[model samples]
Every structure is written in structure tokens, then in C-alpha cells.
Target chain A: MSPVLEVRGLTAGYGSLTVLRDVGLTVGEGEIVVVLGANGAGKTTTLRALSGLIPAQGSVVLSGTELLGRKADARARLGLGHAPEGRGTFTDLTVDENLRMGGLRLPRNELPAALDQAYGLFPQLTPLRDRAAGRLSGGEQQMLTVARALMARPRLLLLDEPSMGLAPQITANLFAELRRVNAESGTAMLLVEQNAAAALTIAHHGHVLESGHIVLSGTGSQLAGNPSVRRAYLGV
Target chain B: MALFLQRLIDGIGNGMLYGAVALALVLIYRATGMVNFAQGEMAMFCTFITWKLADHEFGLGLPIVAGIAGGVIFGFLFGAALERVVIRPFESADHLRQMIVTLGLFLAINALAAWIFTADTQRLASPFPSGALRLGGVSVSYHQLGVIAVLLVMALALRELFGRTRLGLAIRGASMNPESSRLLGVDVSRMLMIGWGLSAAIGALAGALVAPAVFVSPGMMQTLLLYGFAAAVLGGFDSAPGALVGGVMVGVVQAMVSGYVPAVGTQLQLATAFALILMVLLVRPQGLFGRVSVERV
Candidate 1:
């Protein structure tokens, strides 16, 4: 089957400072692809480029449509949902309102169902619905941010560092929830993370991005067992 | 006691006018994160527009209500267009430069109004009935009551807009974080324009309402602007509801100080507003109803 996402020769950078050079990758239908990288491996830049948050030179095909030259919002309408790093929650807004904002581009009729799905997925959020998002704990905020991205009902979800600053237990729960989401909803995910062992357990395919280049690629178990990956990322 | 009540009502009546201008400030501040220094002048311009439209020969000669409606619609379009044309270009610039641009706008708009309407003050007919409601020998004009009623209604309408509507969510979302809002498929620029447009419409209404009392002219809003700024600062520059409370407080304090405080005297009435503003800033800094912004890791 054709991949849900396809990037060819992706090159992105800030002004006068190139970070990602000629990177390429893909995520097939309903698959979880983890892009493992260190602190400055251009992992975040890759997601930003694909989501059209920053200017980049590449051919980004979502499903079948060419995604280049489109604005970030337009790309979102075309079924790309991004839950950015550091829990990109609207702190001032209530949890319910944050979810509403997440489903902002969905058709009016689809919003209710999407909201129901989000609430059902994160039952802890149901009780805290009216509370301002800023007051929520780190785990709850992360859940809120992820749930919010899911509200878009995207064909592919781009998650940047979902485990950063999360406790080990919270990160495990988050990954488990992500696994359930992938298995049940068939939403393809391009998860960029430094948490290799946790990411590998859920990821169907894994690629190690080093200095903006894909240096390793294999099945999840293969990357997880590799000595270099185990030393560099898994820290085992 | 009757004299005090009269003074209180009189203070509230004028407070409502200040509140209207303060609402305009809060609206623009919420959307764009910068105060439009030209907001008062924008209102002054709209008041002139209302005056011309209500003129017997030079304009449509519509009734006062119709003229004000025309002015509001015109103001909406004018403010929205200005956001797109004049403000949007420098929106990405630093706040200081943007503020300077608005100050330039203040000067330019004042000049434009002076050139078009001349420097003469024109009397605007009040749509409210010319009468007073007498209770315990305290006479309250219908016009004063009408101003307070209109301001309350505007506040209620604004509350509904921000609380229950999808468009309101979009506006709030954009104001909070344009980057995330864009990812959610919101057109941040368009929302900002709407904010400016709505603010202008409200400012126009304020201009028409105040015009009947002070008379419309190029400089009519000069003093009113100071009061409006004081109200916004006192209420918390970012809070709509704060603007209402701040406005009434400024008005009452000014009125009472001028009336009863022998040391302050009527001549130092403006000073009273300044003093209140200073006190609030020193004590709360966030204003009465403003939430102190919390940054997260």
C-alpha cells in the first residue's frame, strides 16, 4: 500500500543556519514510525518542515496530495495534525475549549463525535473539562495536547517529543495510549522522540536520525536490540 | 443625601461613556497585543462622519439613529481595512514601532478629520427623549440613562460573543497563541482584522453617544481619551469586564473628588484619575480583574 506520508530530499533551516539536509522518510497506512534522534539531530526541524510551520525545500506528499507551498493551516485541513513539543496547550483556555480549538477545522457535524472520542480516550480529562489548561499537571497537559491533536481526525499525526519532561510512568502511560490509538483508529504517526526503548515497543518501523540524516532503519525490535542504539539512545 | 445621589448618578452617566472607549482599547489589545494610540482619534473621525451624514444638506440627512448606524458600519469597514493595509505590514515588528505607527495614525487621522470637517464644533441631536426622571427631587436626564443602558448592552453582547460562539473561540485562540491557532486551521490575520473592525464599530457608537453631550469636533475626544486610558489601565488593560469597572470607578472618583474634596478642587479632577491609576498600578499592577499571565515550562 502507498504510504500515508512521503518526504523526499527534505532540507529545512532557520535563516542562514541550515539544520536538516536532504532527509527523507515515510509512514505507511496506520503505521507508527519513530524517528529517534539526540538533542540537536534536527528531529524537531523535520516535523516543523513537514507540517509547514517553517520554510523548507522538499517534496512532502500527504496521502496523494503534494503538501509543499501550502500554508500551515491549509496543511492541517489536508489531514496533518501536529502536537508540538513541550505540551502546546492554550493555558488560558479551559480544557474543553482547548479540545474545541483542536477540532477547529473539522466539519461542524464531525466535531461532536471527535470530541466524544477525545473525551472517551482520556477519561481523566472528562472531570477536568471546565478547568483552565494551565492549571493541569504536566501529564494531564500532555494528555490534553495529544487529545487536542487527535480532534483534527488527521490521516497522519506528527508528534514532536511527546515524552520530554514526562515521568517514566507517565511516559509509559502516554505510549500505551498512543499504541491503543494507533491500533484502534489506524492513524499514522511520525513520532519524533529521544525515548528509544519506549518508542520502539510501539513503533512498527524505526529510523535513527543523526546530524539531519537517516543513519539507521529497520523493524522496531531490530533497532531496539542494536548495540549502538541501545548504547546511544536506549542507554542499556 | 439627595445631592450625593445626584452626583453619583451623574458620575455613572459619564462613566459609561469612558467605559465605551475603554472597551475599544481592551478589544484591540486582546486581538493585537498593542494599544492603538489612535483609537480615540478613530472615534473622533467616526463622530464627524455621523455629524455629516445627519446634516440636512451636505449628507443623507438621516435621523440621528440612522446616521449613527451608518457611522458604525463605516467605522467597521474602515478599521478592518486599516488592520489589513496599515497595521498588518508592521504587525510582525516590535511593539514600540507598532505603537509609533499608531501614534502616527493618531496624527494623520486627526489631520484628515480637521481637513474634512474643519475645526468647528458641531452639535449632534440626541436620539433619546429630552426629559428627566425625577425621584426625591433628584432629576436624571433620559440621555444619561440611555448612555448607561447602551454601554451595559454592549458589554452583554460582547460577553455572549466571547463565551458561546465559535468565532469567539477563534478570536480567543488567536490572541493566546497564533502559531498553535494556525495549526488548528484558524486564519489569525483575519481574526485580528475582525477584532479591529469590532473595536472601531464600538468606538463609533461611543463617539455618537458622547457627541450629543460634548459636541463633535476634531478635538472632542482629546480629554475623553485620557479618561478612557485611565479606565483601561485601572481595569487591567487586557480585561473587558475590567474596563467597565475601571471606567465607572474613574468617573465616580473624579466626580466625587471635584465635588467634595476641597483640597483637590474641581480643577484637579483629571489629577484624581491619574492618582487612582497610579495607586492601582502600585498595588496590583495586573489591574482589578486582570489575570496575571503565567508562563509554563
Candidate 2:
């Protein structure tokens, strides 16, 4: 499969402190690539840097366009959907409004279809469309976040810790939905997660990030079965 | 009873003017999370622009209505330019810094208007005909009725804009969560600029509406600004509707206090208005219609 996203020599930090150094990765067309890391491992930072949420020194090419130095909104309009950490829902806005915001760049004629597609993917959100996003439960908010990201119909979706604070069963269902989205829509995804076992279950390939560096890389099963990865991440 | 009714009607007319200014304040506050100390001065400047456009002897000899329209358009461009040029640099700055910048603008814009317009109070022709309609021993002047009618229409139009339009949704989303909004392709910066522009446009209209009452001068909006701030606080800083209601309440209380209270009359009107606001705030810290924000850690 051809690469849809490519990054090389990404170095980013918060004012005076460098967190990600020489980090590099790629997502192939319709591929699910997971980056596994622990707390403070710069997993979130990497995704933010890629999405132009922060200043970074790197070469990030989405499809064929260079994304470095562009504003976050500009990058988003170029078909990069980022479901940020903590499910950055506009708490005051209704769920339907939030979905509309996600499709802000879509052609006006395509919006209804996009909304329909989003509601179909997360059927539970349909009933709560008019309710405020902050009023939704954790599982529902996560579903909304993922569903909102998909509203853009992006070529590449950057997901940060989709299982964070979610129940195991909910996480499983979410991963299953993500897998289905990948299979059906052919949208590539680059997911960062601490939940190694669950992320690996659907990821086509994976990388282990340690202190901002990619320390190991392999196919999903290869990393899942690796004794070191299992002990360190899976707590097995 | 007739006297009381007349005072109430007069109070509502003044209150609508206050509400117009307060609405402008609320718009900027919602968009940028900062209370612009310069809001009144900005309106004052736009009022001078209106005067210049309408004044036959000194400037453009356009019809008063056309001049007011020109002022509103100028206000929009001036406000948008200020946001893009002056305020955008301070977008990421802390609240204190932003407040200081607005305070500086308050002084600067006020001085700029004084220099440009010569600080002389100028007469602005009222759009309404000078007449009063009497009903049941109480009379309401056409100017008062016009102010009330115009404000109601403005408020309803604003409500429609915010409640129904895509631009309004983007602005709301941009203000509430800018970072998340950017990820949604909302162009948060542009939304913020538009917010400032819209607020200034409303302020321009407010200035034009009130110019006939207070006359056009640099210091004209000073008292109005204080009352507008009071109205915004009374209504709930986050609510557009609250600002209007708060303005009317403040106006009624001021009128009633000055008219009825023998010892403390018109001179003590501002104090009485604040006293009421303080009481209401003490009871409900969020103001009449503001939602108490609950942040999740």
C-alpha cells in the first residue's frame, strides 16, 4: 500500500524543553498504525506536532502536501482529522453542532451525507443529537469524539489515546468500530495509545515509543507477542 | 400612577440604549474571553464618525439614516482591523496583559476622538419625529418609542444570527474551545476577528441611537459605558439576552430611585443602580441568566 502520511526528523517541545526527538513514522493507505507509549512518552506531542497544533522542526507530508508551519485549522482543512486527548468536545455546544463543526470544511452539499454517515457509525449519538456534549457520559463522549473526527471524511485520522479512561468493554467495542471504519471507509489512521493489547488487536502495525524515541517497530502480532512489550505495556 | 407610568416608560427607553452597549460588550466577552475596557470608547469613536458623516457644515452632507449606515460599516471595518492588527498579537497573552491593552485603547481612542472632533458637543438629528403619543394620561415620545422599537428589532435580529447561522455556530465553537475548534477546521482566529467586528457594529448603532439624547462628544459614552458594564454584569456576562434584560432592569431601578426617593435623587442614580447590581450579584454570582461554569479536571 502507498504511504498516505510520512514524517521524518520530528523534534518538538514546550518552550525550552524538547520532548520528541528525531521521531519518524508513516501510515499507508487504509492502514492502522499504532504508537504505543507510557505517560510522558511524547505520544500526544507527536500527534500535535503532525497536526500543526504546535511548532515543530520536521518534515510532515500528508498525501503529497507539506504540513509544517501551517496553522492547525489550515492543516485540518487539508484533510487531517485529529481527535485530541481528553476528547476536546465543545462542552457548551450540542452534539449535533459539534458534528457540524467537524465538517466545517466539507462542501455544503456533502454535509448532510457526512452527518448521516457519522450518526450511522455511532447510532447512539442520533438520539442525543440536541443534547450538550458535556452532558454525555464518558463512553458516549469518546464515541462522539471518534464520530466527530470521521465527519471530516479525512484521508488520515490522528487519534490520541482513544481508550483513555474508558471501560474495558467500551474500549473493545471502540476498537472494533475503528477496525470496521478502516475496513469500510478506507481511511488511514495513526493512533497513539497506552493500551497495548487493545490497540494491537486492530493495528496493522505498531511502534513502541520510549522517552520520545521509537525504540521498537514491528507488525501488530510481532510486537504483541514480544515478551518485552508484553511485560512492559500489557503488564503480563 | 400616571407619573410612575411615565417614569417607567422613560426608563425602558434609556435601558434599551444601555442594552445596546451591553450587547456589544457581551459579544466581545463571549468571543475572546476578555472584557474590553475600550468598548465604550470604541462606540464613542464610531458615534463621532456618524456625526462627521451626517454633519452638513463640517463634513459629508448625507442624510442622517445614510450616515448612520456608513458609520456602522466603518465600525465593522475598524473593529475587524483592530482585531487583526492590534489584538491578534496579544491573542495568546495573559488576561492582565489583554486588559491593560484594552484600557490603553480606552484612553487612546478617547483622545483620538477628542483630537479629531475637537471635543465640542455636536447636535445629532434624531431619526424619529419630535412628537408624543398619549394613552390613558401617559405620553410616550416618538424618539423614546423609536429607540425601544429599534433595540427590540436589533436584539431579535442578533438572536437569529447567533441561533441559526453557520457563522454564528463557528463563532460560538471558537470562543468556547478554541484549540478544539481549530482541529475542527473552524478558523478560530478569523471567527474571533468577526466577533470583534460584529460587536463594534452593534456599538456603532447604539451610539447613533443615543447621540440625540446625550449629544455627540468624547465624554458622552463615559457614563453610558459604566451603565453598560453594570447591565452586562446584571444580565450575566455570557448571555446576550441577559445583557438586554439587565439594561432594562438597571434603567428602571435608576429611574424609580431618582423619581421616588426624596433624599437621594437624580445625582445619586448611578450609586442606586450599582447597589441593586451588588445585591443581585450577592444572591446569584453568575448574574440573572449566566450559566455557572463547571470545569472538569
Candidate 3:
């Protein structure tokens, strides 16, 4: 499969404190690639850097277009969608409004179809379309965030810790939906997660990040079976 | 009873003017999360522009409505340019720094207006027919009725803009959570600039509407600004509708107090308005219509 996203020598930090260093990864067409790490291990940092949320020194090429030094909104207009850590919901906006925001760059005629597609993926959101996103339950907000990100019909979706505060069953359900989305839409994803087992279940390939570096990378099953990844992330 | 009704009508007219300024303040507050101290001065400058355009002898000698339209357009450009050139650098700065910058603008713009306009109080022609409509025992001036009508229309148009448009959604989203908005493809900076532009344009209109009554001068908006702040605080700093309602309430209270209360009279009317605002705020800090914000840790 051709690569949808490619990164090389990615390094980023907040102020003087470096969080991600020399990190490199790629997501192939319709591929789900997971980066698993512990707390403060640069998992979120890597995604933030890629999404242009922070300044980074790297070559991040999305479909041959260099994304480095671009602002977050510009990258988004170029078909990069990010559901940032902590859900990144516009808490004051209604569910439908949030979805519309995701499709801001989409043609006006295409928005309704995109909205319907999102609602179909996360049917629970349909009934709560007028409800404020902040009032939704944790699981529902996560669903809305993911659904909102998908409204852009992005070529590459970057998800940071989608399972952070969700219940295990909800996490499982979300991962399943994510996997279904990948299979059906042919959209590529680069996911960062601490929920190793659930992430690996949907991810085609995985990388283990340790202290800002990609220490190990392999197929999903290989990373799932790796002793250190299982012991460090899966708590097994 | 007739006197009471008359005062009430007069109060509402003045209140609408205050509401217009308060609405401008609320727009900037919602967009930038800061009360623009320079709001009134910016409007004052725009009013001067309108005066220059509409004045028959000393200026452009355009029709009153045309001059106001020119002022509104100028206000939009001026406000957007101010955001891009003066405010953008401090986009990430704390509230204190931003406040200082606006306060600096307040002084600078005031001085600039005084220098350019020669600090003279100029007369702006009223677009309304100078007559009173007699209804029952009370009479309402056409100017007063005109001010109320104009402000209400402007307010409703703003409400429609914010509630129905795609640009409105982006502005609302950008203000509520800029970082998330950027990820969603919102040009947050552009939205903020538009916010400033909208506020200043509204302020220009407010200035023109009130100019006939108060006359155009460097310090004309100073008292109005105080009243506008009271209105905004009363309405809820974050709510657009609240500002209008708050302005009307403040205006009514001021009029009633000055009319009926022996001690308050005309001199203490401003003080009485604040006293009421203080009481309301003490009870509901979020103002009349604002929602209490709660953050999740």
C-alpha cells in the first residue's frame, strides 16, 4: 500500500523541555498505525507534533505535501484531522455544531452527507445532535470527537489517546468502530494510545515509544506479543 | 402617570444607545475573552469620521445616512487592522498584558482624535424627522423612536449573523476553544479579527445614533462607556442578548431614579445605576442571562 503519511527525524518540545525526539512513522493507505507508550513517554507529543499543534523539527509529508512549519488550521485544510487529547470537544457547542466544525473545509453540498455518515457510524450521537457536547457522557463525547474528526473526510486522521478516560467496554466498542471505519472508508489513521491491547486489536502495525523515541516497531500481533510492550502498557 | 410614561420612553431611548455600545463590548469580550477598554474611544473616533463626512459646512457634506455607512465601513477596516497590527502580537499574552494594551489604546486613540478633530464638539445632523408622536398622555420624539428602531434592527441582524451563518459557527467555535478550532480547520486569528471588526462597526453605528443627542466630541463616549460597562456587566459579559436587556434595564433604572427619587436627582443618576448593578452582581455574578461556566479537570 502507498504511504498516506510519512515522518522522519520528528523532534518537538514545549519551551525548553523536549518530549519527542527523532520519532519517525508512517501510515499506509487505509492502514491503522498505533503508537503505544506509558505516561510522559512522548506518545501524545508525537501526535501533536504531526498535527502541527506544536513547533517541531521534522519532515512530515502528507501525500507528498510537506506539513512541517505549517499552522494547525492550514494542515487541517490540507486534509489532516486531529482529535486531540482530552477529547478536544467544543464543549459549549451542540453535537451537530461540533460535527459541522469538523467539516468546515468541506464543500457546502457535501456537508449533509458527511454528517449523515458520521451519525451512521456513531448512531448514539444522532439522538443527541442538539445537546451540548460538554453535557454528554464521557463515552458519548469520545464518540462525538471521533465522529467530528471524520466529518472532514480526511485522508489521514490523527487520534491522541482516544481511550484515555473511557470504560473498558466503551474503549472496546470505540476501537471496533474505528476498525470498521478504516475497513469501510479506506481512511488512514495514526493513533497514540496507552490502551495497548484494545489499540492493537484495530491497528495493522504498532510502535512502542519510550522517552521520546520509537524503541520498537512491528506488526500489531508482534507488538502485542512483545514482552516489554505487554508488561509496560498492557499490565500483563 | 403621563410623566412616568414619558420618563420611561426617554429611558428606553437612552438605554438602546447604551445597549448598542454594550453590544460592541460583549462581542469583543466573547471573541477575545477580554473587555476592550478602547471600545468607546474607537467608536468615538468613528463618530468623528461620520461627522467629517456628514457635516455640511466644514466636512464632506454627504447625506447623514451615507456618512454613517462610510463610518461603519471605516470602523470595520480600522478594527481589523488594529487586531492584525497591534493586538495579534499579544495573542498569547495574559489578561493583564492585554488589558494594558487596550488601556494604552484608549489613551492613544483619545489623543489622536483630539489632535485630528481639534477637540471641538461638532453637531451631527439627525436622520430622523424632528417631531414628537403623541400617544395617550405621553409623547415620544421621532429621534427617540428612530434610535430605538435602528438599534433593535441592528441587534436582530447581529443575532441572525451569530446564530444562522456558517461564519458564525466558526467564530463561536474559535472563541470557545481556539486550539480545538484550529484543529478543525478554523482560522482562529481571522475569526478574532472579524470579531473586532464587527464590534467596532457596531460601535460606530452606536456612536452615530447617539451623536445627535450628546453631540460629537472627544469625551462624548466617556460617560456612555461607563454606562455601557454597567450594561454589559448587568447583562452578563458573555451574552449578546444580555447586553441589550441590561442596557434597557440600566437606562430605565437611571431614568426612574432621577425622575422619582428626590436624593438621586440628575447628578446621582449614574451612581444609582451602579448601586443597582452592584446589588444584582452581588446576587448573580454571571449577570442576568449568562451561564455559569464549569470546567472539567
The digit string of per-residue lDDT tens for model 1 on B138-238 reads 88999999988888999889878887788888898888888888787788899999999999999999999999999989999988888998899899988
Candidate 3 lDDT over residue span A1-236, tens digit each: 55999999999999999998888888999999999888999988888888888999979999989999899999999989898877588887899999999888889999889999999988889999998888888778888888999998899999988997888988888899899989998989999998898999999999999999999999999998999888888898
Residue pairs in candidate 1 whose N, alpha carbon or C atoms collide under 3 angstroms: none
**Deviating ranges (above 4 Å) for candidate 1:** A108-112
Predicted candidate 1 versus true structure: per-residue lDDT over A54-82, tens digit per residue: 99997999999999899998898899999
Q: Please tell me how candidate 3 rates in CAPRI terms.
A: medium
User: How many steric clashes does model 1 contain?
Assistant: 0
Cα lDDT for residue B69, model 1? 94
Which residue pairs come into collision in candidate 2? none
Candidate 2 residue lDDT tens string, A25-74: 98999999999999999999999999988899989999989999899998
Task: Give per-candidate clash totals.
Answer: 0, 0, 0
Instruction: Report the lDDT tens digits of candidate 3 across residue range B165-241.
Output: 88988998998889999988889999999999999999999999999999999998989998998899899988888
Misplaced by over 4 Å in model 2 are none
Query: Model 3 Cα RMSD, Å?
Result: 1.4
- Ten contiguous residues with the weakest lDDT in model 2 chain B: B288-297
Query: What is the DockQ for all candidates, taken in turn?
Result: 0.62, 0.67, 0.68
